[model samples]
Target: MRILESDGSIVDIFAIYWFGDETYFYGMPKNYGGLQAYKADEVTVIDNKIDFKTVFFSNDDAKSVHHWALIEESLLDDLLELDETAYKRFLDILKSEGQLDDNFY
Candidate 1:
């Protein structure tokens, strides 16, 4: 899977697979979130790019988790080709929101 940045850059190489009744988003645990059923359809491919609409949850303690409503592919290509700064920013955002998995990064 790939994440497209605002500048149309792609980075963060990952894979998507199905196991039993759930869809797993592998790689960089903090940036990964598993989806099931209807949520899995959120990630779609369009124009050879990927898009996502994410829903976030937070508590008074400032911890949060986000569930992305995958959208049609955008213009992003290789997930590993993203600018280093951008990738770090992405990871930071995920970490700050407590959305990152323990195994991420």
Candidate 2:
């Protein structure tokens, strides 16, 4: 994530997951997350949209969107204010959503 020095496809995948309506594609340590992202599990982490979805949360409903709305908005501001710790905050979310493997440590 070093400006133009970073990989563009990663940004594209993140954008598609955040904004795309029909397809989603993203690869990682093992090709996980987001809609249409091929791989195993086909369960946790959208098992289908490595991106963002309702099932990722518990007791989530239309009202729950507010939590994410705030997180989404704040992430940008937080990232701008503190790059060192900004990205780490998301690890917890991903872990809770089952995207990050427990053994990863």
Candidate 3:
């Protein structure tokens, strides 16, 4: 993953694994701090630094948080263009957790 900075700069992105089927957005604190999931449609950026919010379980909730992350429009766009195979992998993980309703695929 790539984080887009306010000044159009891009930074490497990482994830903190957790249980459940939902995709989570975490705020990575500077200087090696623990990550926190974001809730609500809020995105915090201090002097171009990213901050945390809370986790959402539905698409609407996810979209709200996504809007907040749009501070870096290009970066958000890049994020939306996700790799299909990676997405499938995510679905696989969800299936393993028994989060998916059907295994028709």
Tens-place lDDT digits, model 1, residues 66-89 = 224121222112233444454455
**6-62 in candidate 3: lDDT tens per residue?**
555433232322334344444332322222354212332323322333232244333
Q: Which whole-number lDDT from 0 to 100 does residue 26 have in model 2?
A: 31
**Higher-lDDT candidate of 1 and 2:** 1
Model 2, position 40: C-alpha lDDT score: 21
Candidate 3 residue 47 Cα shift, in angstroms, is: 34
> How good is model 3 by TM-score?
0.25
Cα displacement (Å) at residue 45, model 1? 24
Clashes of 1: 13
RMSD of each: 14.6, 10.9, 15.7
| Candidate 3 stretches greater than 4 Å from native | 1-80, 103-105
Please count the clashing residue pairs in each candidate, in the order shown: 13, 5, 5
In model 2, the clashing pairs are 33-50, 34-49, 34-50, 34-51, 35-49
